[model samples]
Each structure stands twice: as structure tokens, then as C-alpha cells.
Target chain A: MRSLKKKERDKLIGDFRSGSVAALARLLSLCESESRSRRDLMSSIYPVENQPFVLGITGPAGAGKSSLINRLLFVFRKRFERIAVLAFDPTSKLTGGAFLGDRVRMAEHIKDEGVYIRSMADQGRAGGVGAGIHDTIGLLSAFGFEMVIVETVGTGQSESDVRLIADLVLVVLTPGFGDEIQAMKAGILELGDLFAVNKADQPDAERTETEIKASLALGRSQTAEAPPVFATVATQGRGVVELAGCLLEKYQELGREGVIDARRSKRVEAHVEEMLKEHCAMLVASEIKAFRTKRAKAAGRINPYRLAGALISKIFKAENNAKKD
Target chain B: MGKIRVVVAKLGLDGHDRGARVISRFLRDAGMEVIYTGIRQSPEDVCRVALHEDADLIGVSILSGAHNALVPRLIAELERSALDIPVVVGGIVPDDDIDFLRSKGVRAVFTPGTPVEEIVKTVNAIVEEKRAG
Candidate 1:
């Protein structure tokens, strides 16, 4: 394990000159990490870095989400030299099984060198992509992708996370996904930067468009950029290009409005803070047995807070000592 | 410098995280700050966590076939986050996918039955080399 980590770290730094985003992704996958050390190292290595533009696509189940994403990737490939995707798969009710259903739709891009797609199972993620989602994004950004697209589970609760994580969020719907539109009107309707009437080739496409527009009127959003409602047949690849254009336009608008940086930095701060919290908590847990042993040997009034403070200080001192050496 | 910090996260819908949990335990015993992201990680969230923790290596173990799709996209997510941590994949990876993963710049893939000793040694060696840079 130590050797593997060492090898992974060496590869990360050695590639510092070339700065391959792909390498960073590999590192995260191998490490399953959420620590502060390497992230700081990356910041030091590459200063003045800007985060990738994030786009979130969400909606009800069976709303042609996978197909839409596939179509969108095609357009993204044509427009962007670097692109990344995070596809959140539905979790299995029986065993928390996560099947990568998006791969079938995204088969063509699987081999594409410029595009990278990741499928995640929404295993009870309470808030915006579960436990390691933040860490994975960090590894991805460090790798150097310019644009990132995140597709969450086709449900209302999961949509909230996508909205928070992405600079622009697209809420998709189809003709027959009945109360899906009504459900969106409740909260998700307001969260979308773009409303998509997917599978427009199906019957009632026009009616679906009208209903979506009406829902948009009822739904108020923090973004006044006017999230356009577009009709698309994801399977046939219709309107995918238009949707992609709107997505890019929204990205630019977020950049121009300066919301992107603020969001990125804020999320970064939160992400790190959360990781530290987890790290500190685990550190305490890890030391419990040892602490108990040491205390038992001394019987010298072990205050947990004081013990923790001393341990943290020790860590800092050791880090300082390493730097000096 | 400080024993090479590493984080292990189980990403996507692939639940069989046995390898991930086992690896975290191994890395911790080997003297690294190994944090396991429990389960279910979106690429963005994982990246965010990595940036916050400032981890050096982010390990992903996916038994699901989504490795190809998830791995590359995750690499892309890291790019957007301005993070550049090295990544290694573990779990049920097919032989054909190995070359493909490496081409996407994956550091390495520890296929099934890989000795834990090899994992520990390789991690240490890899981190040492990277930290020197």
C-alpha cells in the first residue's frame, strides 16, 4: 500500500510539467482519498488555475437522460477540446447495487481521447453527490479538463445536489413522464438553468413544451439568465446540438457574471473543510485504542480535548520538521 | 512529506466496495492518512473532497463496468477543480481495459488477486517519487 501510494504520488508530481488531468483521475481512483496534503501540493505545483465549468443535467427517471447525455457529449466533443462527464446511476433497491447504465449510451466516447465520462451510483447521497464526490472532482480538475458535466439520478432529491454542484443545471422531461413535470414545479422547476423536453419525437411533444414553459413561469430561480425550454429527441439526436449550445451559453454567462469562481471557491472551501472533519474524526477513532493504552499505563488524567490538541500539534510539528529537512 | 496522505473512495453505482475498504485498512496500517469515502461518490464531489483534504492519491475501486466511463470522466472532473492528484484503479478490471485505462493516464490498475504487499510497497514508492518532484 505504501509503495503504491508512493508510486502514485511520484507519477502525479513528475507529470506536473505536462499536467495531465487523466493522471489526477487515476490517482483519486487508486487512493480513494480525501486528505489535504496532495491537494495543497497540486495547488503549489500549478498556481493560477481556474476550475472547469460545471453543468448539471437532471430530471425524472426514464427521461432519456442517458441518451441526452450521449447526444450532448457528441456536441461537446465538437466544441470542446477537453470535456468530462459524471453520470449518476440509479441505486438498486435490493442491495445498493449501482449498475453503470450510462456506458451503453456513451459507448462511442468511451474510446475518445479528449472526452472522459464517469458513472456514479446514487447510493443514498443525501446532499449533492455522496461522500467522495468532492474528492473525485478535485482529482479530475487537477487533471485538466475544461468542462465538466454531471448527470444525477432522475429524481427530485438528487436534483438538488446537481443544482448545487453545477454552474448550470438542465432539467429534462418527456411527453409521458406525467407528474414528473408537476413534481418539478415544486422545487426542481426553479433550479434548472435550462428546461429540456426530451424525446420530442414522441406524441404530445408540443403539449409537453407548453406545459414546461408554464411551469417555468411558476418557478422562480436565483438565475435570471432565462433557462430556455427546448425540445429534443435524444435517441434520434435531435435538438441535442441546440441544448448543448444553450448549456455553453449558460457557462459563459456564469463566467461573465463571476458566479463560477465564487461557487468553485466556496465549494472548494467546504469540500476541504468536510474532508478535514472526516480526517480528524477518523484520526481520533484510530488513536482511541492507543490512547487508551497510553492512558492506562499512566493513569494520568487524559482529557480528550487536550489529547487531541497535542496530537494535532505533533502532526504540524512533524510536517514542519519534514519541510525543514 | 508527512507519510504520504491517500484517500480511498468508492465511486458510482458499483457497490462491491470490499476492495476499497480492505485497501483503506492496508494503507492506514502502512502509515498513511487513508480516508475512505464510504460509498457512492460523484466525480465532482470526490474531486471536491480531494481538494479539501489535499490528498495526493485518490483510489477508486469499481467492480461495475462503468470503470471506463467513470474513470475518464473523473479525470476530467479533476481538471475542472484545478487538482492534479495521481489516480490508480482497483477491482474487477478486464485485461483489455487495462491498456485503455493507462492510455487515459491512469497510474496503474491493481487487478484482482493483487497481493496486498505489492499494493503497500508500490504506494510508498509512488508517493516518495512524486513528493520529491
Candidate 2:
């Protein structure tokens, strides 16, 4: 019951929309809490629609996503004053906790009032992006950030989830990776709107770039423009400015072609579907709990499949009757 | 639905992180959302993060014995910033300083060998009371 009251939470969101960083933090915490009021706060803030250009960075672990993000921030900050980052780290399977080391990696911008960096635990989401990420992005956009950069947990395969949420996705790679090309074929290659071979100072950098180019040439999207791959040494800040420019240019091109709008429209549709499914699941869960309490021995005696059908019909019937009244 | 938000931070120059990491895992297993700030964070950094995260409680792990200096400053900074979240300290504090820490508004202190389950239960009780009021 550590939830903020509705009125107070709404006031906090109002303050957040008016440029209160602390209020923004409070709102994000609420969003992460999985509370009912999280939806209320989101609805109240939804009307203040300032959509920031969302850029997602994801790759295999140790691909230097955080380092590149730090460099990208330096590049993006020159043009945009207010930027926010949502960096996700993998949650411990046994403990469900996470060590969000990205803040330390992006420490250069920690003291800057213009930058809001938040670390999120992935919570074992099948996709790299956690469930709370979508709402957090909405909140950040509503809070008036010019650009919101999301760094997903650098898991190899399911990282493609970034495409569902981001306007542009950059899949980072490093030269010395053991399975370089093989790993790319593991389904991450197709998700990149753009690619960056970080640590370009390494010995096999050129080979990695060439292999990526070959892969892209073969698997380029037919419906969309081919994504460009850039060579970057993120630690030394090499080729990042050009990469950032290319990303922005691609975003603008997508926006012009209405692709950005189409993606966003699809995202909202998915969000609504997800919410509806969650609501239905909640109703089912409550019904099951009530049934269990009413007939505790029924769990051992009855077939779950049959019981579920009966309970679902009863729940829907009750809902429809209430609606008709 | 009101999942507890805990900020686990390391203050001062303590480099040891095993204890902090363990506590974070325990808190997470107990169904709290734990946001861990990595090693060598300043008091101001902890307070700022807690404010942004809207943490219900903060747990600081300091093995550098800077408890007397750093923990007090952290509490004062949280007070100064008007963030009302409770603070909990862990790590290598001497027994003599335990009462002093509690007196200065620390909700609890988990010294070496404190049970993880106890930590979880105590944190839940503290947050439950605060939120209920």
C-alpha cells in the first residue's frame, strides 16, 4: 500500500509536465511499481503529448552498448537540451534483482540537469525490453524530453524487441567477438535500422565491418531502405558524430515517408491489446482465487480445463449483466 | 500492486560489492524492485537517485568505515532535499555506532551476518507502516 494517493500522484505528474525532474522520477517509480494507479497517472499525463524521438541501442553482451550510448549522448546533447535514457540490465533469475551499471558507464552526464538516466531491471522478460518500458517511454515523452534513448539488456537473440518500441534501432558489434558473423545471423542482424562496429581500433575491425556489410547486403529489408553500418571507436569517440547524424537523417526520412507514424500507430495498437489482455487476465485471476476459496477441495477433485471454461463463462456473464444495467 | 521500491547504494570509497549484491538479490527475491547504484557513489548522488526513483526505502552498503561521516551526511542531504524516504545502512559499522545511526534517522542497520530474510521482512514492515499512514 505504498502507493501515492490519486490526487497527489496527479499533482506530481502535473509538476513533472511542468519541468520538475523530481516529479518525473516519482512518476517513473510509480510506473515501475505495477500498481493500478500507474495506469491512472499515465492516463492523466497522456493528453500532454510531446513525442520525443526514441532511439534504441541493443546488442550482444559486452558489445559496448553503454559506452556507445555515452558517446551518443555527447553527440545528441549538442543539438538537444533535454534527453532521457532508459538502460535495462538483466535481472537475476534466482533473486530478480539487477545491477544497473550503466549509470556508472554514463557518469559523464550524471551531473547534467538536462540528462535523465534511469536503469531498469529486465525481470527475465523474453524480450530485451521489459513490460514497464513502454509506459516509461510515454511518461518521458510527456515530460517533454527532446529525445529518449533506450539501451536494452544486451541479450543476443530476443533483443529484436527494441524494434517494437524504438523509432530507430542501432545494433552494436565488436571486432573480437568469437562468433562474429555467426552471432549476427542469430536474428539480431535483421532488426538493425543501423549498425555500428564499435572498438574499431581493434585488429579485425575491417573484417568485422566487411562481414556485417555482406550480411546486410543479403538480408536488407525489401520494404524499407537498407540500413548503413558505421565504424566507431566509442571509447575514443571516433565516427560517432557521423553515426548520430546518419541515425537522425534516417529518422527524418522515415518520418517523411510516414513510416514513423505507422510504427507508432502500430505500437499504440499493441499497447492497447496488451492492456486488454492484462485486464482480462486479472479478472480471471480474481475469479480463480474466489473459486479456490469457495471450493478449496475442488482443486483436487475437478479438472482444471473444465473448471476454467465454467469460470470464464460465469465471469463474462456477470460482466455483461453489470454492463447492461 | 504497491511493489516496494528500494535503492541499494554504496557510499564513499568502499570497493567491496559482494554484500550489496547479495542484499539486492534478497530484496528482489522478496518481490521488491531494487535499483542498485554501483560502487563509489557520493551522498548527493544517492539522494538524487532516491528522489528520482521515488524509493520507499534506501539501503547503503559502506565497508570503508565512513559510517560516521558519510551516513550522517546522506541522512542530512535527504532531509535537506525534502525527500522523506527512509534510509538503511549496511556493511562494516562498529557496534558502538548502531544507536548513533538509528538516532540520526536511519531506519535500520544490517551489520555483517544479518539474515537476508530478516532484511526483507523488516523492509516490508517499514514501508507498509509508512504507506498505511
Candidate 3:
């Protein structure tokens, strides 16, 4: 409920501009809190803009997803000025929360001014991408990141929310997780803009590669080039160059094919949905606060404890009464 | 000379999270807000996080043997980016690698069995020293 001072606000934006993670985190926490002032602060911060490339990396567990991201970061840092990663983890089966683990993986680079990482804990709200990842990503973009990586909770491909956040999707797999038809059974197989058979050191990587090509061929739409599969031993830093190359290529192809804009439009739809929920919550909180203020001003008769005891009941009653009318 | 912010990371596939969670908690308890990047991290992502976090301490815990490859690259990335936060590596380090880590400019290479009380004391001392001098 604290209102941010001009100094704190300036310092936060300054730290963010200077690549200060702590300032960014505090700002993010303030932005995340349910407060009227926070909404105001976010609105001011939201208007600033930077176009960051959103990349999604997803796959089944034990598929070397973390390892591949490591290699890609190393290769990517060589080219991009700054990089942000939002690694998603399921908070629960239905209520998965996305946590930022960029700090853990690259702990040594804490001093670098170019990189920023955040973890979003899922709030279990209705509508996908809980708590509005698209808005959060947009906030990061405005704060000055050149590239953003949205890594889905690399377990089941059922979490299609990452697709709403990323411009390109890289679905990873390991060899022998299933037969050739495994790719056809659906999950992450069809969603990828690029396919990678990670753990290339393993015996089954080659087979996974063949399966991806065959399945992709069956998906058959001439408007877009079939997703290409690559083999990678990301832990040892093998095959990352090709994967990065492929991501760049696909980004190009999607932009040309006009689906990039289509996805952008879809992302906007999701963004609006989140904004409405925030607006409703704000509305409810304000109404409650106003009722409290008026009650306090006119406090001549009612006992405090009795009023407190029936608060929840009254709130529920108010809600139900509103619906009935 | 603003307050020094830090991001603590536990890298590689090591699932031993007790120490890290404790450190992050301690750092917060110590009056410095801390961001604890959860387990299974890569070097590049760690570096990216540190930079993004605007940290004064790039603390890492490596229970995995990949410490050799991970720590040095992390330090190197910080150096390359001209964002030199004193790196403190903790976890299962042998006596042999202790000096190597220090020589590589890692401020303090703490290992297992180190008292949490002592770890907190030392980190405060180091950060204080940095702030003073």
C-alpha cells in the first residue's frame, strides 16, 4: 500500500537503465502488487518501448531443455546486446507458476548491465498465461531488453501459453522417448517452429531426428516451410550454432509469411483479457475501501467486533446481491 | 555507492537446494534483498541473470562437478561485460580448487560444513569492506 516516491521511481528507472537487477526486481514487485498506485506506476512504465525478440523453448522433461538454453545463451550473447529469459515452471498441475532462474545459471554475470531475468509465479487466475505474461513481457521490453526468451515449463506441451508469448517456438526432444509415430501423437511435436533432438551424444538422437522430419512432413501446409529438426549435445556445447541459426531463419520466415502479425494480434487479445481482470480486482478493492471509509466517518452505533465478524459475509452478500439485480 | 543488490544462483543439474535457499533467506535476513534463482541453471543464463539482477555479489553454489567449466565462464562473462561483481563460489569445492578459484578473482570460495553464521558474517564483512574502501 506504499506509494512510490519520485526519488524511488527515478532510482528504479535509472537502475533498470543501468542494468540493475535489484531495482528491476523491486519495480516488478511493486508492479505485481494489487494496489491503485502500482497500477498507476505500471501505466507510466508501460508506455516506454523496446522491441525484443520473443523466443520460446519447450520440450518434455529430461530432454536437455536447460542444457540447450545454456548453449544458446552463450552463442546469443555474442550477437545480441542484451538478453532476458523467463523460464516457466509449473507451480502446480493446474496452477503452474513461472520462476526466473537466470540468476542461478549465470551467477557470475551479476555485474553485467546488459542482461535481465525474471520469474513469474502463477497466480492461478482464469485465462491462460496467468497474471498476464504478455503484459509483463511488454514491461520488460519497455524497460530496454533487446531479446526476450520465454521458456515454457518444459514438461508437457499442453501449456500452450508460451506460444502466446513468443514469436518463435523451439520444441526440443531426445532420442527414443517414443517411436516415429510419437511425434504424430501430438503434444509439442506440431507446435515447433524448429525441432531439436538434444543429447546428441545419446544413441537415440538420430532416430528422433528422422521421426521429426517424417512427422513434420505429414503436417503438410505449403504456406510455411516444414520445421527442421537438428541434433544437439547442448551440455557439451554441440549443435547450438545450428539451432540458433535455425531460430533466426524461422523468425525471418514467419515475418515474411505474415503469421508473425497474426500471432501479435492473438497476443494482444490475451493482453486485453488480463487487463480486464486487473481492472475488476481494482474496482472491487476500491469499492471495499470506500465502504470502510464511509463507515468509519459515520461510526456512531455499530460494534466493531460484530462488523468485523460479518465482513466476509457482507462482501459475499454484496456480490450476490449485485448479481441478482 | 547505493545499496549492493545480489542474485544468488545454483547452477547445473544439482538438485541440492537447501544451502542456496538458506543463503537467499539469510541475505534477505541480513538486510539485503536477495533473488534466489532456483535449481538446474546454465552458465549463460546465470550470467544473464546476474547482469539483469544488478547484483554486487554473484554468489554461486555448485554441487555438480561441472563447477570447473561453469564458474570460470561466469566470471569471464562478467569481466567481458565490464560488470565486475566480486564472485563468491560455494558448495563442494576441494582444497585443490580453492586457490584456483581465488586466483581467478573469486572473492571467497566457501565449501560444505561452513557454518551459516560464519557465512553470513563473512559476506557482510566483504560487502562492508567493498563499500568502505
Q: Report, for every candidate in turn, its global Cα lDDT versus the true structure.
A: 0.70, 0.84, 0.70
Off by over 4 Å in 2: A2-5, A33-36, A176-184, A219-225, A285-317, A320-325, B14-19, B29-31, B113-118
- The C-alpha RMSD in Å for every predicted model, in order, reads 11.5, 3.6, 9.2
Specify the poorest-scoring 10-residue window by lDDT in model 3 chain B. B26-35
Candidate 2, A209: how far from true, in Å? 1.8
Q: What tens-digit string does per-residue lDDT give for candidate 1 at A1-325?
A: 2323656667666764476544554554443434555455444444336477778888877888878988888888887788878777554445443444454466556446677766555555654355566655665666677878888877654467665567778888888655545645457677787888888988988887887676666546756445689999898888888888888887787789897777777776776687678766865665676777767675456676787788878767765897899
Instruction: Name the candidate, 2 or 3, with the larger lDDT value.
Output: 2
Off by over 4 Å in 3: A1-3, A14-22, A92-113, A119-132, A180-182, A219-224, A281-325, B1-51, B54-133
Q: Global lDDT for candidate 3?
A: 0.70
Best by DockQ: 2
Q: What ranking emerges by DockQ with the best candidate at the front?
A: 2, 3, 1
Candidate ranking under TM-score, highest first, comes to 2, 3, 1
Identify the leading candidate in terms of lDDT: 2
Writing each residue's lDDT as its tens digit, candidate 3 over A36-93 gives 5655566666554566788887787667776677678877888788887765544333
Q: What is the RMSD, in Å, between candidate 3 and the native fold over all Cα?
A: 9.2
* Model 1, runs deviating above 4 Å: A1-8, A16-22, A34-48, A90-97, A121-124, A184-186, A219-226, A283-325, B1-133
Note the DockQ of each predicted structure: 0.04, 0.40, 0.18
Please provide TM-scores computed only on chain A for all of the candidate models, following their numbering.
0.75, 0.91, 0.75
When summed lDDT is taken over every stretch of 10 residues in candidate 1 chain A, the lowest stretch is A25-34
Reference contacts reproduced by model 1: 0.00
